[model samples]
Target: MTWTLKLVNRQPMKEKLGLLVQHALKSGVAAGHLRPTEIPLSIALETPRIAAHGDYSTNVAMTMAATQKRAPREVARIIIDHIDDSGHLLSKTEVAGPGFINFFITQEKWYEVLKTIHDEYEAYGACQIGLGKRVQIEFVSANPTGPLHVGHGRCAAVGDTLAAILEAAGYQVEKEYYVNDSGRQIHTLGRSVFLRCRQILGDAIEFPADFYQGDYIEDLARLLVDREGAHLPDMDEEEAVGICARFAAEEILSGIRKDLEAFGVSFDRWFSEQALYDSEAVRSVIQDLKSRDIIYEHEGALWFRTQDFGDEKDRVVVRANGQTTYFASDIAYHKDKFERKFDRIIDIWGADHHGYIPRVSASIQAMGYDEKQCRIILVQLVNLLRGGSPVAMSTRAGEFVTLRQVVDEVGRDAARFLFLLRHYDSPLDFDLELAKKESNENPVYYVQYVHARISNIIKKAEERGYKHMCWHDDFTDLIKLPEEIQLIKLMARYPEVVAQSALLMEPHRIPFYLKELAAAFHAYYHDRNKHMVVSDDAGLSAARLFLVSAIRIIISTGLTLMGVSAPETM
Candidate 1:
């Protein structure tokens, strides 16, 4: 169970391949096999699906074929001739399928991958490809009218995981939550609570069709009455509504924070929309736009020249009645983000906000900022189900299943893992029954079981008198089992998977990788007689134990990045 293995200093296999390819190409030029020119800037290396082909394959020869005025196969042959297998990184090089160079790595080199996994453990899949750039990820900016629903759960999972992956990739990342506390919805919430308060005081009043109709509003009203007492009924109606608005907003927002915290999502900052208006930042942004001739008065309203900047039509920043639009405050908020010097800003929004991207991007350009600096990731809907039937949800009527409720039902780990099982853009059907099941069909359990199974194996090994020090000892040559080799190959891909996920800002890849790793471990485990961990052969036993120990570390690492727990006993 000890994961604190000593560090093993080694270059990444992929980097070694790139270096080897470059050296061969240079040798080709030196021998006059090809024309002398600058080497290609990047050499792409990929794992072939068929293991017999090789450990890695590249099309660099095909790329050089046209430039060298020779067949791709001819180019591949010249490059292969110069490749040195003395380093034992590559056992042999093959020219396959129209000059695709395939590299068969030595088994000893693959053993080093397990050593790297053991050495890194928690930092196993981490990389520095981000180059320490600062990134801001804002998600689940739902209005603080009520508790977060299941859809917000999906956003929370994606955003939190993306931040973790980016940080793991050596980027300075900050998770943010935008609080929309200054909009028409806030006023409507105030009205809803005021009506509930009137009813609490035994007044006869009809509830408006447009007002919020949730029980939380009544709870806020009750809280207001408990604090203010009989004096509230005698106060001016508008004055009562104003006090109620601030009170209800704070209460609702407090609930939101609690729910997010329970779901394991926390933000570095809670930015308020009202702060923009209170500090006159919205007006300042509009003035800056006007100074740049990006705004003009049309129909007695200040209009942003959005149409000129690729919007379908001009957008009104300030209405004729002097009320600034929501779009105006958003522009100000994004401007504030840029002024704060974030190298990259990513917004995770609901799929319904797809149309909002163009106008926001246009506004960013109109204000003399690069539109590419801001990227919006639209998370599609989450369909909650029970026994193959859809669960009802409606944000407008406040009848949706709250994130807290979902977590309470199946626990936080299942909720997070299920939310991240698919790409953010694809709609997810979350079957409640399936998530709660304790069988292999349940993906969360299947992956977590792998970690627990490895722990049990190591525990059995110790119980059978095998010293824990055996894992730290050298046992590379003894680990040549077929299943063991396949397991090593899959585990070797973890660092690349993490780098790709971070580069693409996609957290779904982590869950996919974990599932694949779990399958490999399960396959290896099923052959108990062949790959026994506590065999009489000390060298083979130590090697199998070491392999399983590495698997345990990787499973824990992958689960941790996705904000899910890797249970030692599931």
Candidate 2:
């Protein structure tokens, strides 16, 4: 399973067709049919939005018309005249509208996808487009303050699924969780816990309103009291708070790890902010930036000239009090990431951090690395709903619905699926009642049912003593119904969909494709006349069975990419 072999086995239809269009342009140029001095470096082929337009439409002719000194349609006609269809790839080629070249692939050529799917099975849509580039994706790096809420859950799902997609597209990926363990928040958490411990010890201390009010803090305090009750009565307040902070941070982080594991998210590394300071990396980065003149003193503060590299203004790396800002640590963290030699660094942050992109990009650029190498994905907030009404959540007050609660209530499959129902940048409204439903209204159930239905069909066929038939040369001819053709076409587009999704760094496309595929299968299944997988006609039955088996494989693959389950039953 060399990368080259994988690519050869799954070269997408779009790529193959694009090559033909490229050849056509070259032929026209060489034969002097067009007046361009040289052909363009690449030809762009896109699927026509309207099915009636054609399977694929390219506007290369329009792009070349000026240089060719001819009307767009005339250049298109000349390109069509020179196209070599020796492979029988296109059944019809039309020059339509101003200059677009529309290609209708032959039915037989489309059927070849069925054999490819049969041969490839689980690896049908996998591609080597990434060529094993090393990519580090840092995500769900939620501060170790409290239990993860639904918003964190959504970020987890998006990052995990995006990693899966990049892997399928042949990129070596590492998932990371950045633990912000050293900050004011951790001290606040410790103080909160220490106050709770005093209350547990019957002290009449007033709890501050600004401290963490989550019930989890009280729970941590109780645990701490049970572990060190005898010494707490005599311990110094600052010393006890430090101990409590360390204890609470470690406990909360442990719970965070467990919840992510239960949610099917795992990290290759748990990077600590304190470690950067301990190793002097943060201070070292500031000095390096100062030597490069990227950092300067301004009004008694150390400022980084971020505005010089596209930021709205210079940013303070260290305040007048001489404490380093979070931005300083971030610069050091990203500098370390670049030094690690990953081909790409991806950070998934909450949408509220959208304004922070430019400064981070500036930091990367200031560090002498291309800012493009660092990609940031912003995940929007998730609004949890019960029966369409909003579920209130206050993180500091600790009334929020934890990711654990959602998973426990609706199961991991539904939770992950619903979290990824929309793009990461768009706010998601996750309805608890809708997600738990067992009917088609539940998108996960709808997609998973396609796999289950096909599984049952195959099982029933086997029980009826129908011997399993491998894909045959004539199977395509037998599968000529409009519905069957449509399914094969959709399946043929799977490889392209995956490659495009990876290229665009979008994982939502996978679910969108799966839903479309499931709908097509459901429509075909409900029409009883064409729905039988095992019938008197052995050839047709075998072809239909193979068609559905391919469908099952795709459904399973898509769900697996989303970190969802494709259950055999319900």
Candidate 3:
């Protein structure tokens, strides 16, 4: 049998089943077997947990039953009867519990996915769900006063992976890091370094309790002394502190850049908070709000009417002392984002910033944009552990584990994969020992091992003189084992997984799907007698080789989305 490769990407198996269900509903209406009401614009199809249920299940019948004023199973029976399987898409259909229509798809239909993976290769799981809309994801915008911590690492992984998933779903994506390089924090950093510099020059000084106490402050002071030859303490104190603040901020920001680069995250822009003030954007926004009466002076401070736009209460944008609040700069920053014309604005902030979302979203609305356009993802903190015991960390004391240190301890792949194993909103307990493990207990190793195992199998097959076949070759009946069919079904769900993960704006779904796929493949591989890939039967070996190669492609693609590598060797 000759196979024809279609130029267009094939619809996912779930989508195909949805279309078939829609066709059956229309056919039942046309035949007068069911009452004509409204059909759902989009039907929902789900996979059954138990293997015996069916390949795909849908409750469209039950949804229609309420409108049809008929028993659910009766409607299900009518719909299933009218289902047009002329394309040989389904082997059988059954009305299961409570009117769910379970569809058992044909083996030939399932086999088509292997060929689809072959035809599309790396692009197999990609879809055009995003439709080229512009999206800006701002994450890990940690204050430049200190190095990034474990929590910042989680934010980086989630934001970067979400951006990659959106890109795969066809969104025009840009990643941004907002730099908080101004305000009191920077001044505090300057004072900390200046005090350290004075102590370095043999002047005994008592370090203030409020000052930053990390050894990094001393490092910065020593660097300043090396550059200026211990004359900083002799200069005017205020002028010297000003110089120290600028120097320390730049040095810390540079370290943040190196750490993120090592963690494999790059941003399209680094927006400056000070630039907002310097360019008068902050003043301009406040003036605009005043002109529109959105800002009113109550206690000698300018307050934005956030309550008008769904906030709990009005907030002060400019304090009574005439200095703009951090909220003022936030308003200006988000207004700048809207002015950039991004269709969607995503902010990945720590869960502690949960209360800040309402006011910022209100600012977006006050700027004459839809508040819904700005999406805020709050990531919970990471509790660092060493062999299940809590790892001590104190940010003010500068004794916390930095992102650089974590990446150094556990490789980037392990750090990233473990960071994404759960949803962003859920707190993660990151164990150093577990991440360093190379065995099956470690998730990254488990997933990466599947790719390596498949590579070794393909190499062994090539050495045994098995030529890889083209997509046009017919291999339907050759891969008939239960495990092989299950693998094909799992592989077929990848495109849907990518699309859904993008739709929900959750990057954890990709890792979850990959872990499931890896477990299934491992089970099949370990059962060597029944599931050998390179058997003496040339036709069977060739077909199994084709299936395993497709699996490898999916694993590699999933890992790439997570910013992890798919090594050919463990």
The TM-score values for the models, in the order shown, are 0.96, 0.95, 0.96
Candidate 1 lDDT over 1-570, as tens digits, reads 133222223456786788889898998899998788668976889999998789899999998888899999999999999886557788878999989999988888788888888767799889888899999999999998888989999999999999999999999999999999997888888889988998999999998878998788899999999998957768898898888898999999999999999999999999999999999999898998898889899888999888887889888898999888889999999999998899999999989899888889999987778889899999998999999999877767768788899999999999999999999989999988998999877899899999999888788888888876434436766887777888888888898889999989899999999999999888888887787777888777888888888999999999999889887776
Worst 10 residues of 1 by lDDT: 1-10
| lDDT leader | 3
lDDT of 2 by residue, 1-570 (tens): 698755553567787788888888888878877675778776888878898889889999898888888899999999899889887889999999989999999988777788778778788788898999999999999999899989899999999999999999999999999999987789999999989998988989898889999899999999999998657757888998899999999999999999999999999999999999999999999998999889998889999999999999999999998988889899989999999999998999999899999899999998899888889999998888999999988875778899999999999999999888898878999999999999878988899999899888888888877676587878867888877888888998998888888988888999999999999999999887757778888888888888888999899988999999888876
Angstrom error at residue 157, model 1: 0.3
For model 3, what is the alpha-carbon lDDT of residue 348?
Answer: 96
TM-score for candidate 3, please give it.
0.96
lDDT per residue, candidate 3, 318-357, as tens digits? 8899978899999999988988999999999999999998
Name the better of 1 and 3 by lDDT.
Answer: 3
Instruction: Tell me the deviation in Å of residue 217 in model 3.
Output: 1.0
Cα error, candidate 2, residue 219 (Å): 0.7
Name the runs in model 1 displaced over 4 angstroms.
Answer: 1-9, 36-38, 84-86, 469-474
